[model samples]
Target chain A: MAELLRTHPLEAWAAALAELPDEVRITPEPFVAMVDVRVPAAASEGLAVRGTPLPTAPNTWTPTADGRMVWLGPDEWLLTSTGTVPHLLEEELRDQLRPVGGTAVDVSAQRIGLRISGTRAREVLAKGCSIDLHPRAFPAGRSAQTTLGQAGVVLLSLGEEGFAVLVRSSFAGYLASWLLDAGLEYVPLG
Target chain B: MQLIACPWCGPREEVEFTYGGQAHVPYPDDPAALSDEQWAHYVFFRDNTKGRFAERWNHSAGCRRWFNAVRDTTSYRFQRVYRVDDPKPVTP
Candidate 1:
């Protein structure tokens, strides 16, 4: 068995999201787990780490049959998948990346993943985010890391009008409040 | 918020990036050999250009990486955005 060294990053915010407006909900995504990987784009070709290639195109993400790969920088990517053996996975990824002078390590606990989806989710996100959320510009499969509520966050389009807002655990509470406040105008009185 | 173009992430709101002060300031190759005054100059003083200036910015909210930008101080318009490794684009 591989040794583990991480705790759930979003545990503190789980209960808080449950109380968000029913019309525009902020739900803690299931802990799928994450790892940050880095490799030069030239060397990443034909190299599939955990069945996902390192994405080089800026602000884009690639989906695998089992997981997803997000391009972080010219040489950085974040790999995410569901697994209990973080140590083993990180070790294997590191070994594979070594030949190309790249590395992979765990960052699952560094961020909290939030799924903000509802009829009014887009409206709420537009309040604090500058990116044009219109379907044509940020279609599904597109991803961008930008400041939301003055906190750094990676915004990924999940589907039509639905989004995945990823933020460091420390900023989860602040972003959630911002989103809730932005959505207040739309929530029906109950 | 103003829009800042990132070489990688395209244009994002300014709040997503952190101002890294004056750019083109390199660390001394041998810090231990520098005199006290020289050290102080390197650490404390930076050109506050009134016109066009070169500076570093970290796309903290986007790519989470640092890069350089040349902008007109008076107009607050970015003249260029380039990678850290690339030569600083000439400022006019």
Candidate 2:
């Protein structure tokens, strides 16, 4: 049987990283097991992942033993973990939430992660993003589903000018191009 | 771009939202009992109020939840935003 290998979507864009200044960095994250969770708002209080409660507040995230749970909507969340197997997490979540009229779906392949951090990290992101990136307005621990250029992305603040941009796999190239082009202004001619 | 307040995600750019037309258009209790004209009206008619129009807006790109909003069609200012099940509030 032919071997099946999981590949990173931005593997081809690794060379583009050279154009960005050292102060601004964008690195593609390794494959993460992501599960889309849907539970009743009232019942969510009883749901826990490795003893870590899901974040009930909008646009917030709570850390788990392996990863974190990000709030997507009033009754929706994205559970991302790098340490666990995707199907196992999905099954575990499904069994736990089934009693509460909820569902869990394995969406690990739906999107890819990119970590952008450094002094000018916010500046590069601001070029194509419209949301106020000020620390007071969008402090660390906050996340927002907004647009970067024309691509829809989930921006997670990682403190001290660091952020995680999660975009659909299909739009990864466009976003990488946009970020690189935006970062070029910081690169010196020499 | 305008800022549309999502009831769940708070205010986000207007580009993240898609217009959902008039709000409070409930489905008929008895669809089979309705006359042809009433059925057509239910499917096609919507109030084009000039001021303080109550409408539905979907935060398509943001939280992806649908909410209701009351805005002045003339001034293009959103008076208030409420949840889908919440009762509409009086707007100026």
Candidate 3:
């Protein structure tokens, strides 16, 4: 299973980091991540899980006991785990929900989750996206799907100065490479 | 810019949606019995109300769902947003 899992080039790049220059600062903030879970429409059991009908169109965000769930589309949701996400929950969701309709493809391993924080995080995002990221408009705990440098991305504002970008697994290498090149001018924090 | 409230996604930028024209325009139950002029009226004629009007809009960018809203044609302010199957008051 370890060999089957694809290696992200950025992982190697991060592993290679050593001493830093006096003027340039770099730090690592790990454990921030994302996972793609696909459940077929049938599995929803006419519940309209994402945006079909049961829940009605225009997917809504409802608070749950554990965390918040954002309906991405029909039969799809992006679940934000409050703390560490256990594999058991994923397995349970599959067992309970998968039988009603389509297969659940766990693409959690496909994408990379990067946490960009600090005073200049918004400035870094502005270089790529067009939407207003100001606190008045975006605020914390808001997530939206939009284009970032020609790449479709899910932008989530986690804090006043923190954000998470969920990029496709295949594009992770390119996005990380691009961010590194662009972030060179900033106080680089990993 | 007209402010159109999506029934599902709530109010969003007009750029994220597509105007779907007037709502509540149902097809004639018996099209075979209607005259050509009546058929034309049913197909092409639109009320084009100057005041509060019910219209359809699709959240093209966000939820990709179609819903109904009551919007003022003059000020372009959306009065109310509701699902398609929900009952709406008839303008006498």
Alpha-carbon RMSD, each predicted model: 3.3, 2.3, 7.6
Q: Which tens-of-lDDT digit does each residue in A1-190 have in candidate 2?
A: 1122687789889888755778889898878889999999998875675578888889987668878788999899999988778888899989988988989999988989999998999888888888888889888889999999999999998788499988999999888888888888888888
Scored by lDDT, the top model is 2
Give the higher-TM-score candidate: 2 or 3.
2
- The TM-score measured for candidate 1 stands at 0.85
lDDT (tens digit, per residue) of candidate 3 on B1-92: 55456655455567677789999999899999999999999989999799999988887766566788888899888788887788775655
**The candidate that achieves the highest TM-score relative to the unseen native structure:** 2
For model 3, which pairs clash?
Answer: A27-A190, A42-A100, A42-A101, A43-A100, A43-A101
State the DockQ, from 0 to 1, for candidate 1: 0.73
Residue A160, model 3: lDDT of 52
**lDDT agreement with native, every candidate:** 0.80, 0.87, 0.59
Write the residue-wise lDDT of candidate 1 on A1-190 in tens digits.
Answer: 2344545555665666666676687887666668899887678766777766566677888787656788788888888776546666688888988989998888877777888888778888888788998779988888998878778888888775488988888887788777767877766678
True-vs-predicted CA distance for residue A134, candidate 2, Å: 1.8
TM-score, one value per model: 0.85, 0.96, 0.54
Residue-level lDDT tens digits of model 2 in B1-92: 68888998888888889999999999999999999999999999999898899999999998989899999999899889999999989865
Where model 3 places Cα greater than 4 Å from the true spot, the runs are: A1-69, A73-75, A79-95, A98-114, A123-141, A146-152, A167-190, B1-3, B27-45, B89-92
